[model samples]
Target: MTDATAGGPREVPPEQLHLLTEFVGRSRWFGGKGRPFQVVGVRRLGRLPACADDGPEVAIDLATVGFEDAQEGSGESGQDYYQLPLAFYTEPQDRLEHAFVGHFEDSDFGVRYVYDALHDRLAMGCWLRSFVDQPEGPLRFHRIPGHELDLDTHSTLFSGEQSNSSVAFGEDSLLKVFRRITPGANPDVSIHEVLTRAGSDHVAALFGWVDTPALRQEGQTEDQVLTLAMLQQFLRTASDGWDLALASIRNLYAEADLHADEVGGDFAGEAARLGEALASVHRTLAEEFPTEDRTADQLAELAEGMRRRLDAAVEVVEGLAPHADRVRGVFDALAGLDGVQVQQVHGDLHLGQTLRTVRGWKIVDFEGEPAKPLAERLLPDSPWRDVAGMLRSFDYAPHVVERSWGDDEGAQQRAYRATEWATRNKRAFLDAYVGRELTPAEQTLLDAYVADKAVYETVYETRNRPTWVGIPLEAVARIGES
Candidate 1:
């Protein structure tokens, strides 16, 4: 039974509120890092349907975190929502010492020991069973029929993830638990659902997802859907595309005499395959989703948006100041264009977002830019944005390897080889993707999108990795030359 004393969902136990605050502060998925922030509120969403008669109780809580220094008029409130799933036990489990949240006296269960449910296999089993069983509750488990789930498999949480928590159940399925909470359709689940049902081989097939009706806050008219987790086919044998690219770069540098194309580990062929995969996915999206040609006014607005971003980026990235004018000129060229097509795309396409399975290339993560709000991420964008992101990623791969060399001998030679590798792969990818020579308008669009993407990279690197800011700055300098 939930308390409805305050005209809202039940608040987290007052004594346990501090525990959540401390847990969120140290969490890897907490987005408010380096900012003055606090857990302002925590409300119990619901308890999960028990997996067994004697299994630990599972409960989901939503924490409202407020940032003290959020910028006004940034199109965001000074707060964020995070989901915390907890498992309660009668006794503290020594195996889950690292996963402990806190202990409390429960009125129903009494003397409860709480832990992050994601870290507990038994707790995760409840989630898996819910998807398999489809029990009625606040959390709805929607499934796509085909493969039978391995219900007996144990869950192991992946440690390398940053923004979200992923639990792999043996080798069969992966459950991506979204840390940040938002009240709308999640593009990741939605896009994967579409591509999977369409029989697209370029993406991981969506198995099912967990969502619930969002708690309507003050001033809200209607309830919105809040997605919690997504279950999908885990590519157990898949290698990360970024790792593959880095290895290719490493192979190139080892043979000082050989060009990128002549190397045994040349990634040009793979790059072309990836390009074809992207093109196929884009065609499918354009067919399934609403696509439209931007009028002259919309094109002008798009250009203005890019210009504004450049203007703001120059302030944070001092290196961008020199290349700002050239980049601005590239963006300014977009205003004259018309009939630029826009549709749903991989919002943040990069080599890192790809997986090379035995079958071929598989793109993942359709959530777009992590920094942007969900509404902005769902908007239709030109496919050139995706193309430009991959192009920029190709540029980054070799340069990243070169940076590791630091002031070593053959640095100059390595730099030249890096350029050769990036250029060759970029050409191979672009040729395969477009499948023809670009028209003047297409070239204009591609150039602007690439320039815009590079500009974004400059800002991101400046703020996150100051020493590596030179990578994107170099790309920025070549804006007009290409």
Candidate 2:
């Protein structure tokens, strides 16, 4: 925990402080969970310079702390430091939106506070200074009437396991405040920059960004995600790909007595259309960007990495061994192929990462796997990795729904129907994708890519989410049997 104050600061009342601490712990945005946490300390960053008529001067800053016990209460821990950046607004009844108050209680001295470190003006100002000079470029700031600005400050939290905090503004603009900041230009910003420059309509438009020059810490550069605010034409009636798929699955299950082709709410059409959109996007990427032939060494490296991941997964779920071997065979077969095209691709593609609007299916978020190192995500790879990711997502929808509905007979029936729906749409999508005439080499490459993706999922699910691991394990088995 880095201190933002010049020197040490004072503390609040024990009851007020405890209320604040408890309030923070209950928040959905708060990352620290399953661990005992005490304030350890708090420092008021500074007053938010009175806006008008001597209103509340919002103070903000970081905090430092130590665990009560090293290894007993919270499983395991040492002197762990945390970045407890916060914003305190005195106009609790007026300025505070009380975003998550319904989810958590705040008693007396209940000043409205939000974990707004990501989009803090200071942070964004810092980030912006690095790329462009102040008062120019994409990082422009001006003082508007406080009342006018207040009306425009509508904040709604995005729902998902996000790597950062995002709040949409007026449906036309989006601000993605990165959580775990890295020094380099983030790929999400970088890729959107290219796509927008290329006049690509398939992706959200990139208006601009804010960044700051980082300080040199030890031998490394330290940069934070001040703010990556982008303006785009928001889809007014757009449905996320996950919702669309879930709806389709539910509809199909409801009409399971009818043939999928004859079903009223069939997803085949959407799937085919999405497939076409993806193909178009891929073609554009290939045309605008350079690609290279995947060398044997590169393939070997991928194989080794995949093997290690699979081995770890198998250790966790012994039931996965048979499926793992089959998935391995697919990779082994692909390794023999020559001249596979390698290019930059969406390293993490899934239903949640797409949107279906009046314009059609538009891919969103190009940040790649959040857990992977930046270098690995930026690396050029087979486009099939993306394809496999989508396919796996398709498989997850029904299984997830089934789990949600419980493991009763009714749930199994719904799962079965959903699987049928998924299979039908998957074929439809693949047909649209493969229908594009391709060289035999391209076909081989695509197959290998899909195999690699399934293997990746197998490892990921097994490690982080044991319950969902079976879905990818099943995919590996099916791919092998095929």
Candidate 3:
């Protein structure tokens, strides 16, 4: 490894290497944790020529391994360094292009840079120039008549979203440069392309994508292979799913004293509309893609996974031992339930995955949870999985807010009010979903799915956020009580 601090590159000292390793591990963006990592190799990709007020840009390739020696107390083996990429940009003067504003952060070693190739003029120019020499895929941008393409001057980056970086120019143009490039066409890009082309109003509009024939090779390859970016119509005033749900809950609690029928800001209406939108999205997906029958083996696998998760939860909530039999009964009932319809559904759907604008609720981020493998996330599953996810969101909102307030009585009251609102809206959503009709079997399947989802939540909360475990633990108890 080499240190690029003080605007020059030098072989990273042992102490600095350790510090860099620790720094990467501590980053919220760094995925791996609780594991041993050794920086096996490093290669500097050369510095970018200084342009205007901007300092030189340094690109480096880091090769790392976990437990290469097969030693005990080492982390998982075969972990690839290809998963992690870092870029550093330095400037003699702090003044940067408006495109780079707010994107770069001050670090111990100059300004630690973020890759927003789409919006950063310099990065965008470099990316475009790299692609301009040899166009990849079907789409290609030609220099306009009598206009010379100045790759260095024409690039700019987009704002927001730490997950992915993007760049754009004017209303009709944009490119979302994905940071974590997994193999195969990303579902977010793939699904949105289909929905947008199909004229599905429920999804964001997708223009096109750029990809290379093969994955970019570290150090050796100048051309980045695979889908580098996606172009789409950006939502200007979009409100995310979390904010929308919070607004609805706030209104519902404000009107808790009023009759449920008379309450203003009742989420029932919005919930029903969202349900209808989801149904339409499902219908479109079913039409565009083929559905598969949920075989016994598949159900068994799902049940087994659920069992493992529940067992973990049970370990945490040992205090609920008296109710273990009832909880097991619910699981047994779910395991035995039939009429499982399998289709392409959103693997992870939560309030945070949606957006509300002047128009209506727009579903986004079909990439699913980052932790899961892409193949598993893209697989067809029960539509009720998504339904269950939303229901879980409804349950999560109040509990999260309650914890935010230190579990005060006022907060608890607010939580109760929010729960009531969520329940009422959930019923309304079901009514809209069922369209005034549901076979007894379908209703049973739905209920089972909901229980299964609650069980999943119990495990997730127990592990990731133990303080909030009570919310799902209560849900597990309520399943039997109801």
Best by lDDT: 1
Question: Which lDDT tens digits does candidate 2 get at residues 1-482?
Answer: 22233223445556645655665565565545666776555444232222334222223332333445556665454332223334433444333344322212223226444434333443322322222222432223222111121223344446667656665554645556554443455677767777777877677766565443322223654533322333334555678888877776666667757756776777789888878877777777777667888777777676667667667767766577766667677667666666667777878888888888887788888888865656677777778777777777777886776666656657666756767766887788877876866565565555556666666666677667878876766666777564
Worst 10 residues of 1 by lDDT: 1-10
Off by over 4 Å in 1: 1-7, 13-15, 74-76, 106-110
Clash tally, candidates in order? 0, 6, 6
lDDT of 3 at 383: 83
Candidate 3 segments exceeding 4 Å error: 1-27, 33-119, 125-162, 166-175, 213-227, 254-256, 259-263, 320-323, 337-339, 407-412, 480-482
Candidate ranking under TM-score, highest first, comes to 1, 2, 3
Q: Which candidate gets the maximum TM-score versus the true structure?
A: 1
| Cα lDDT tens digits for candidate 3, 304-356 | 67666666666766445555667666556556655467777777887777777
| lDDT of the candidates, in the order given | 0.88, 0.58, 0.58
Residue by residue across 96-209, what tens digits does model 1's lDDT show?
999998898644446799899999988999999988888766678899999899999999999985699999999999999999987788999998999998899899999999
The lDDT of model 1 is 0.88
Q: Please, what is the TM-score per model? A: 0.96, 0.75, 0.74
